[model samples]
Target: MTRSQALTLKSLAIEAYQPGQFEKDLTRAEAARRIQMLRDEIALADSF
Candidate 1:
C-alpha cells in the first residue's frame, strides 16, 4: 500500500480503539467497514 493509504488505515485503526476520543460512536466492525471504504475511495481516486 502507498504511504497515504497506510497512514489512513493506521489512523482508522487508532480511532477504532479510541473512538470516544474523537467523539465518534463507532463499533469495531463499523470502523473496519469505514477503513475498507477509505481504501476503495483511495483506489477510485488513484484511477483519475
Candidate 2:
C-alpha cells in the first residue's frame, strides 16, 4: 500500500490498541499488517 494508506491503517491500529480497541471493523491481523507496513517505511527511510 502507499504511505498514505499505510498511515491511515497505522492510526487505526493505534486506536485499536487502546482500551476500547481502535477499529471496530478491523481484525488483529490487519492491525499487525499496518504496523508492519509502517515499520517497512521506517526501515526504508533509515537506509536512505
Regions more than 4 Å wrong, model 1? 1-23
Question: Distance (Å) between predicted and true CA of 28, model 2?
Answer: 0.2
Per-candidate TM vs. native? 0.48, 0.47
- True-vs-predicted CA distance for residue 13, candidate 2, Å: 8.5
Clashes of each: 0, 3
Candidate 2 lDDT over 1-48, as tens digits, reads 445554566575455443333344555576667567665665666798
**Model 1: how far is 1 from its true place, Å?**
22
Best model per TM-score: 1
lDDT scores in order: 0.55, 0.56
Residues 1-48, candidate 1, lDDT per residue (tens digit)? 444544556675564453333224555665556678656666666799
In model 2, the worst 10-residue window by lDDT is 15-24
